[model samples]
Target chain A: MDVVVDNLGVFGRGLLVSIQISAATFVLAGLLGVLLTVCRISPVLPLRLAATGYVELVRSLPLLVLLTLFVFGLPEIGLIGPLLWTAVAAMSLYWATFFSETLRAGVRGVPLGQIEAARAIGCTFGQVLTQVVLPQAVRTSIQPLASLLIAVILNSSLAAAVGVTQELTGQTQLLDQRYAQPLVTFGAAAACYVALAFVIGRSAGILDRRLAVQR
Target chain B: MTVTTEAPVQRRPLTVRLGSIGQQDAALFDVPGPQAQRRIAIATALSSLALLALVALAVRQFAINGQLEWDKWQLFTQWPVLRYLAIGLLATLQVTVVSGALALPLGALLALARLSRSPLLNRPAALYIEVLRAIPLLLLIYAFLLGLPTTGLRIPLFWQLIIPIVLTNSAVLAEIFRSAVKALPQGQTEAALAVGMGYWQTMRLVVLPQAIRMAAPALVSQVIRLLKDSTLGYVVSYLELLYSAKVLGEFNHTIIQSYVVVAVVFVIANLTLAAVAGQVERRFVGRAHRT
Candidate 1:
């Protein structure tokens, strides 16, 4: 317990890095997700096929393998970047597929009648999409997106494997190695993660309730 | 309470939405007019060219890195190398199977306890499920890996990996089971009780069978997750596919090729599992509609 107290600054900074990675991934992946979702539902055959294939392929592979590939494989192709950015890039690429799926599901949840009603009211394709589809999709996706954010935070720990040791899990491992207090260090780290997850989940719940469309 | 006589609405299988673009696409867009068709055709051509260029760029990089060399991949063609990877795959499957077998039953019990009328059973079950679900599986694995050794418990490498996976997945599986149970019509249980059956008996005979069928696809999806989690066996140096690939990569000096091959193997295995899950879901949906 004293070990954790003595290293409070270390844990706090590590937690901050984890949050930064998760935030970066959420924004980047969310944007890419919207693009993929658009392509997936678009009329262009090749774009649809390409987007679908990417999502399916990425979804099947493990995040750790993907991380190792980016960390080791990308340099051979002359695309080296900072380790932190590499981890973020890999995570965004991976989670974008999931984000697209959730967004697609959210679009699916939009009633067919609403789209028809919008079209009947002389709304163009762009207007119908931007006005009718996106708003409701955003509302329906809040909970799943919250869950994905939590997943991103949890998965950011994988960065440690690829030598990004500034995050909570990696720093905990460092402390454990230095002090041999795995229970104290790891227990504190777990508490931080659980607390973050709880906060995200509860906030999302409140947001969902506030934005829920009354039938 | 009124005993409703309506046929249960056919809920679309989650796999259909997940695995493919469903009929919802038609609702999302209008059928193309001639002008729209021509625009789509041009867009398709442009996208195809873009995709082809991306592929060419990737191939060029591989060629430049000498990663496309026959010498690099030739190691995989040999019998010994194949056997070594096969052994690693066997170990991966062993961990998945053992952990999955333990997790499914334990998860079912947790779900049952959570759904029980007594707070004594349900409260602790809820806590276990929520806490486990929130924490990353890697952390749990680390706990076992680092924490156990400190207490003078020198367990085998296999158990170290398997124990944490079981702990984490059982919680997720419990949630899956609980949702499937809750989705059932309350009438089914009431009917069973009315027919002179006790609560546990109704659950055992009437509720669980259908819940399992309903949950089959989701359960298979969880199996895919379990398979992916087995790759974490690498962290413990457990001779799983990823770890073996790393070892073989180092020995053969073909790190990139080795990881790529193992990744392909994982993708193929997972895709096959996903297809099976879709099939199970279709069968269940068909059965449900017929009844």
Candidate 2:
């Protein structure tokens, strides 16, 4: 018990790193996802095709492969950085593809008649989008977006595979080595993950209820 | 500051483009105007150039690093290398198959318990699903790796990966099955009961089959996930594809090449699975429409 207490600091640091990576991944992937969705739905045929290609290509490969490529392949081009950042970049790219698909589904879910009505009411294309389409799309998208975030958080555990030691999984692994108490150390890590997942899940549920559309 | 200067409303050309795109038929959108065609042509040309430049840069970097050695790839043509990769592929498939076979019934059982009337079964099933879903597959894998041997069971290392995967995947599969079951029209279950079938009989014959059919596409995709996930076997030195890639990379001093090869193999395999799932889903949808 004392040993476990003593190891809290290490676990805490790893947890912090995991949070930092996940937060950055969430923000970056969100922006990229929106961009990709826009590209997907844009008038530019090439852009749409490119976005589709990118998503499919990324989707077909495993995240571990992407991480390995970034870890081993980045330095070749003089793009050296912290292991965590590299992993984050790879992960964000991997997730942005899925996020784009999710957002695209949301965008498609919006009723076409609403957009036509907004346009008939003298709304510019931009106004129709910002005022009418995007709001509803975003509202419809919250559940999926939350699930995507949960996936990012869960997948961030793979960062440890690439030697990013400042995450919950990494820290737990380190402690497991030192204390030789796999059940206790990993069990503690599992508790932390479950707690984080619950927080995310509960918040998503609250937002879903609060933002429920009155159809 | 006395007179109000009109700052231009920054035109969101992109959003406008998206709106226009959405309004038009995706294929026929190109047939309308020369202006649209030219715009598309210019965009394509520019994007192509950007892609080419990115590829060129990567090529140059690899060239400088002397990682473009033809000999490094030749090893792939040899029997030993093929055998090694085959072994890794076999390990991955074996784990995915065994775990998947186990997960289906376990998941169905979990789903049944969750949907059961009794709180005793319901609460624990729900609890198990939520807790297991919250846990990362990696952590579960690690726990099994470290904890299982302590039981003094001389279980093979392969079981370590398989057991954890089955446990985690069953929770996920349970949810999929639950959703499928819930999505069924209430009439089916009630009709089965009306025919005087027992509850379990109704579930086994009427509910479960239809639900499993509805969930087949999702189940196949989940199997693809299991395939990719079996790569985590690298952590415990289970000699899956990724681990084999690492071994080959270390042996040949061609880390990036080995990873690229492994990635290609995974991509092809997963893409094939996805294609199969797509076909199955279409067939199911088509059958429903016909019926």
Best by lDDT: 1
Worst 10 residues of 1 chain A by lDDT: A71-80
Scored against the true structure, residue A62 in model 1 reaches a CA lDDT of 92
Candidate 2, residues B216-275, lDDT tens digits: the string is 888778877988788888888889898899888888777777888888888888888788
After TM-score superposition, the amount by which residue B28's alpha carbon in candidate 2 deviates from its true location, in angstroms, is: 13
Instruction: State candidate 1's DockQ.
Output: 0.53
For each prediction, how big is the interface RMSD? 2.8, 4.5
Q: Pairing residues by index, what is the TM-score of model 1?
A: 0.93
For residue B43, give model 2's deviation from the true position in Å.
Answer: 2.7
Question: Per-residue lDDT for A75-172 in model 2, tens only?
Answer: 75467898878999999899999998888778778787787777777886678778887888888888898888888888899888888877898788
A1-215 per-residue lDDT for model 1 (tens digits): 99999999999999999999999998999999989988888867778778988999999999998888888778866678999999999999999999999999988889889999998898988899999999999999999999999999988988887789999888988898889988889889999999999999999999999999998
Docking class of 2: acceptable
